[model samples]
Target: MDQPTRPSKTIACLSALIKIGSSQAYALFDSGSNTDSMTPEYANAIRGPRIKLTEQVTLQLGCIGS
Candidate 1:
């Protein structure tokens, strides 16, 4: 029997300093990512606008089950 081939991994990351509400923060940029996320504490600290979702959505992280 033949074995299935694994997909190639491509990782692209960049470190940058960004400004949020007059505050500067170090951030990592991923050009190939489909979604972006931040910690709940950081989100609250940024004091940015929040939108309530009509429905709950689940996200699947690579190598880490949701």
Candidate 2:
């Protein structure tokens, strides 16, 4: 049987909610959003092959702004 391949580096994410004075604060530690939230500078820091969405999708629009 062929063994699975392992990446050179591993990524992990942790989320927790802590009670504050009058509200709860969410704490997130991870690579960050998958939807490309990193700045151009930070994106260049990654040292691996990056996959980007290339499919062109059509979005249906209803009459609203007219």
TM-score of each: 0.57, 0.25
Best by lDDT: 1
Q: Which regions of candidate 2 are displaced past 4 Å?
A: 1-11, 30-66
- Model 1 scores worst on lDDT over the 10 consecutive residues at 4-13
Give one digit per residue, the lDDT tens place, for model 1 in 4-47: 77565644457889887777888998677887777778878878
CA lDDT of each candidate? 0.75, 0.51
Question: Which residue pairs collide in model 2, if any?
Answer: none
In TM-score terms, which candidate is top?
1
Tens digits of per-residue lDDT for model 2, 1-66? 876887757545576885544545565644633432323543455433456759953544346665
